[model samples]
Target: MTEIRVRDLRTADPEDTAAYAAVRRAAVPALLATAASVAYSCEHAHPDARYRALVAEADGEVVGTAQVGIAQDSPEPGQGFLNIYVHPRRCGLGAGSLLARTAEEYLAHEGATALYSWVLDTPRNRAFAARRGYRASRTAHFLRLDLARGGLPPLADPPPGVELRSAADFRDDPRPLFALDAETAADEPGDVTAEFTDYAHWLTETWRHPLLDHELTTVAVVDGEPAAFTLAHTDGASRYASGMTGTARAHRGRGLAKLAKNASLHRARAAGFAEAFTGNDSENGPMVAINQWFGYETYDTEVRHVRTIA
Candidate 1:
């Protein structure tokens, strides 16, 4: 076996990272990937993000990569994440182990006390994480919808006092969406709780993300007030992704979330997106049920694994 070396990604040769991302997309079809996304991530990473992308090479060829970073926006300190991906054809060359070790050292040096990673729910993958001092935490499922089939529910006219609009309408003032995001994110299932109190950061990170398709994103309003929304993202291919969907606390159980998502899906299909993808925590029954109603099927499962470094 050839010796494998892990090193930080250099911006000089973009083709190298693009190839790395290609390997990831092939290994994990549930994820939305593109060369632009890879480059944007490296370019727009927050200063406090402490981001470090590592690529593993063996026999002079890149075979594996890992994205390691601190959860800088989390309210809790010392929380970090390290997700590793190895090309399916290169798994047995010790690339996975090398990437894991390198990521851990980087996180530890950055004062991270605990690290979380997602391992596919396959037998071999689960066993690998268990042997490395990591324990299972939570499970999430990736779902896919066939937009080309055109079986989506008919878009219903907004109820008498309700209106529908695109997220792009709030270009001048996105605080309303930011507020909704902060509330809904607090309820999401995760090891590290995110506090979306920084509106400026949200504008720069979420609203301005390269893949975000504000035109297709739907926002529901009642009595001229924002009630629910569905954020959409696309790779400019035939694929689309539901970035986030949420209803305000005051509008729960009113079917506003479903309404917004349906509108977004309808627009996506009309725009020629053949496939749509979304993910949800296994414990989030409401969202899971909503996705099922849209004909999305669970195509993959990932188990969150956590390890304490200190």
Candidate 2:
């Protein structure tokens, strides 16, 4: 008899991790996820977060997956998150429901008070979350640009004392870039209110990420100091994604983030990437405007939902 069962995503088994990535990609094609990145995330996640990936297996095949964890860097305590997805073809097989209940039980037992998850903007997906007591919070848009023919803006020379650099340039000393990322990320809009204060954590979870394309990531150097950057994540294929685009608080009005993104996109195109993808919070007018200026079209949207678990 075939039955659905939820279990840990075994990082040691390459097949298991690959299946997890497969289901997630099938459910959300806009996302750039790889087996390496999935395993790396589970192996290097911050201990405080209690992070674990769960997969729903039916008939010995993975049909659904979930990312369960607490907000390790959030200022508030007992904040947890669960992101679940089932293979588009395998929906209605009860995998999604089983994953949700199992994930909630884990988070509730871990002292989670506020639980959050992302549900795709579809009637069925919304109804699933609502049945579990989650209310909509915010919406985020995933935008895509045709790198080969989006009419990408031509590269411009940086102003005097401002130069564009690649993330690879900072390999010898990434503390400067880390400092810049921490400053910019803290100011970004979010419900968790997380702080990126731990340098070691950043290096582990961000810098060493499998998808991070150092050569494609552009950094804006102001008088030899890192101030803005556009991080790039590539699937080692044709797909390229903007991991983050941010500028330090001191360099907000200088348009350094836009400058870095332009450089990154140009380089990615040159390297033969066919498509570029990025996501922005619906409320982030400035970022949305920048993405729009890049000729990126809203391809998909996901709504965040939150429920009081305690």
Please give, for residues 155-186, the per-residue lDDT of candidate 2 as tens digits.
88998899999999999889998988888778
TM-score of candidate 2 versus the correct structure, residues matched by position:
0.98
Off by over 4 Å in 2: none
* CA RMSD of all predictions: 1.3, 0.9
Q: For residues 1-310, write the lDDT of model 1, one tens digit per residue.
A: 5989998876456787677778788778867777777777877787787998888999878898889999888999999899998888888899999899889988899999999999989998899899899999999999999999848988898888878999989888888889888888888878889988777778878898888999998999988778999999998889999999998888899888999999999989999999999999999988998999999999899999999987
Best-fitting candidate, scored by lDDT: 2
* Clash statistics: count for each candidate: 0, 0
Stretches > 4 Å off in candidate 1: none
Instruction: Give me the displacement of residue 278 in model 1, in angstroms.
Output: 0.3
> Candidate 2 lDDT (Cα, whole model)?
0.92
